[model samples]
Target chain A: MIDLLYFAWVRERIGLPRERVETGAATVAELVEELRAREERYALAFADLSSLRVALDQELAEFDAPLAGVREVAFFPPMTGG
Target chain B: MRVLVQAAPFDFGAEAQAFADGAAGAGAIVTFTGLVRDLSGALTAMEIEHYPGMTERAIAAIAEEARQRWHLIDALAIHRHGRLRPAEPIMMVATAAVHRAEAFAAAEFLMDYLKSRAPFWKKEVTAQGADWVAARDADEAALGRW
Candidate 1:
């Protein structure tokens, strides 16, 4: 089980902030693809990866990075907080 | 070091006084407060959103980096989340150092880092609808130069 968090417009699009997701994937990109396949909301939320940022275990990472042992994955729009 | 991320607005004068209350060694206290601008009142309101745990972690990291860069005695950063109207105070940074230069520099540095590095997004509610302010390339460039 992995905790997936969404923020900003991503949260609005996904209609959630966090969720316990079950996935059989080796990389963050695969997980994203799996999510995108689940529903239209996920599709829209993950549609534009260029404008989104990802974090694995609270460290910034690219979507293609391996997620073999990662416990958490967070997706959010371009960080506007300062 | 005190780092706060909340949805409710904060009191600047009170926060500043509390930080400098009993610190006799500190010779200078510098502070910066960011308010929601009118911008022609085009934006009647704004909603600030942020990731929960991640938001706090990012702000803490920025504060830690600032402390390492400057000779800071005490530092504080408070940012509000959720919905806010125009002219509201969005954020505040306070730095105390032995000299004015260090205090000023650290405070400014913290603000700059927070603006670019922090994981917060704002959506302006105007007459039409909600719009996310595009992350300024200039802001990102500013962060890179630091």
Candidate 2:
């Protein structure tokens, strides 16, 4: 099982902050595809991939990055920190 | 180096003094504080959200990079999350080095990275409603200079 987390508008849209899901997806992109196909809310939150950012196990990563030993995945828009 | 991600307010004056005092050999210290902007007078508060585990890790990495690149004697960053009233301080960064030039440059570098690279999101709350603050292209561009 992989832990999925969301923040900001993504969390608002998804209606929850975190969840555990069991999946066989090989990469972050595949995992996203699986999520987008699960329901309308997921589809809407991930409608535009270009506007989103992803992190694997607390580190920023690319969509195509493999998720072999990854345990946590976060999805959110570009950060406005400082 | 010290990185603090907290929900409570911090004393900037005291933090700067402590950081400076800790760096006995340092000749220069630069500190920058960021406050929530009211702008049009409609903003009631600013809500900041951050990834818990990632926030600290990301900041420590940034601070370490600054320390190595500038050969800083010491550095400190404090960022506040949760609801913040207009004009309230949102965050602060301080850098100490052997000279003024290095201290100033490192502080700027830390600010630039913290703006875009850190994992914090901000929302502006006005009397009318609350809205997420979109990331600006200029902020992303600022990173290119470094």
Candidate 3:
């Protein structure tokens, strides 16, 4: 199981900030695919992979990053900080 | 280098002064304050959200890079999260160095990284409604120069 965190619009669409998911996915992309299959909300939030950014265990990572031993995964829109 | 991520309002003038004073033997001190700009009368407030631990770590790494690239005597970055009003200060970056060039460059670099690399997200609330601020391509491109 891993903590899945959503922020900003992703959170609004998913209607929750975070959740714990039990998965056997090998990569972040595989996990995304599993989540997308679970419900329509996840599918909508992740409809376009280009529009979303992911962080593995609090560090910016690519979708293909391995999830082994990872504890947290955050999905959000591109950062708009200053 | 020092990085502060908080929801509370910060005293810009006092913080800038203190940062400058703390850098012993530095001849140049440059500070940039980012304000929540509202051009239209409709804008009421801006809400900023961030991942706590990552926010601090990312900012500290950016500050460290600035310190390594420039001959800065000291550097400080302060960013605020949560609901904020127009004209309110959103963040500040200050750099102290022996020369103005290093101070200015480091401060600019800090701003650039803080915009794209940091984990904060912003939502702008107007009289009509609230919307998440879109990330700009220009912000991402700005990183290429450095």
Candidate 4:
């Protein structure tokens, strides 16, 4: 099981802050595809890949990055800090 | 280097004084504070959300980069999360260096990275409603200068 976290509007759209997903996906992109296929809320939150950023185990990563041995995945819009 | 992510309001004056005093050979110290702006006059508060573990790590990485690039004597970053009222400070960055140029540049670099690279999202709460502040393209462009 992979721990998934969502923030900002993605969390609002998905109706939760975090979840534990059991998946066999091989990469971040594949995992996104799996989530997108699950429901309409997931589809809407992930509809635009360009607007979203992803992190694997607390580090920024590309969509196609391998997820083997990864424990946490986060999805959110571009940061507006500072 | 010190990075703090918290919901409590920080004492800017005290922090600045402490930072300046702690720098052993710093010829210059630059500090920048970002405040919640009520541009529309209708804004009641700014809500900031951040990824718990990643926020600190990302900020530390940015500060580390600034230190290495500018040969900084020390660096400090403090960012607040959760609900913030207009005029309240949202974050602050301070850099100490042997020269004013390095201090200024390092502070700017830290701000630019913190704006785009850090995992913090801001939502403006106005009397009308609440909306997430969209990431500005200009902010991303600012990173190219580094």
Quote model 3's TM-score: 0.98
Q: Model 4, range B60-102, lDDT digits (tens) per residue? A: 9999999999999999999999999999999999999999999
Which pairs of residues collide in model 3? Answer: none
Error of 1 at B107 (Å): 1.5
When sorted by lDDT, best at the front, the candidate numbers are 4, 2, 3, 1
Where is model 4 chain B poorest over a 10-residue stretch in terms of lDDT? B36-45
lDDT of 2 by residue, B51-146 (tens): 998999999999999999999999999999999998888999999999999999999999999999899999999879999999999999999999
What's the TM-score of every candidate structure?
0.92, 0.99, 0.98, 0.99
lDDT by residue (B1-146, candidate 3, tens digit) is 88999999999999999998899989999999999989787789999999888999999998988998897899999999999999999999999999999999999999999999899999999978999999999999999999
Proportion of native contacts in model 2? 1.00
Q: Comparing 2 and 4 by DockQ, which wins? A: 4
Poorest 10 consecutive residues by lDDT, candidate 3 chain A? A49-58
Give lDDT tens digits, candidate 1, residues A1-82: 9999888788889998899989998998899899999999999999989988899988789988999889989998767755
Q: Interface RMSD (C-alpha) of each candidate?
A: 1.3, 0.5, 0.5, 0.4
Q: Distance from true position, residue B37, model 2, in Å?
A: 0.7
Evaluate model 4 with DockQ and give the value.
0.97
Q: Pick the candidate with the highest lDDT.
A: 4
lDDT of each: 0.86, 0.96, 0.94, 0.97
| Model 3 lDDT tens row, A15-80 | 999999899999999999999999999999999989999998889999999999999999999999
Residue A79 in model 2: lDDT:
98
In candidate 1 the C-alpha lDDT for residue B9 amounts to 77
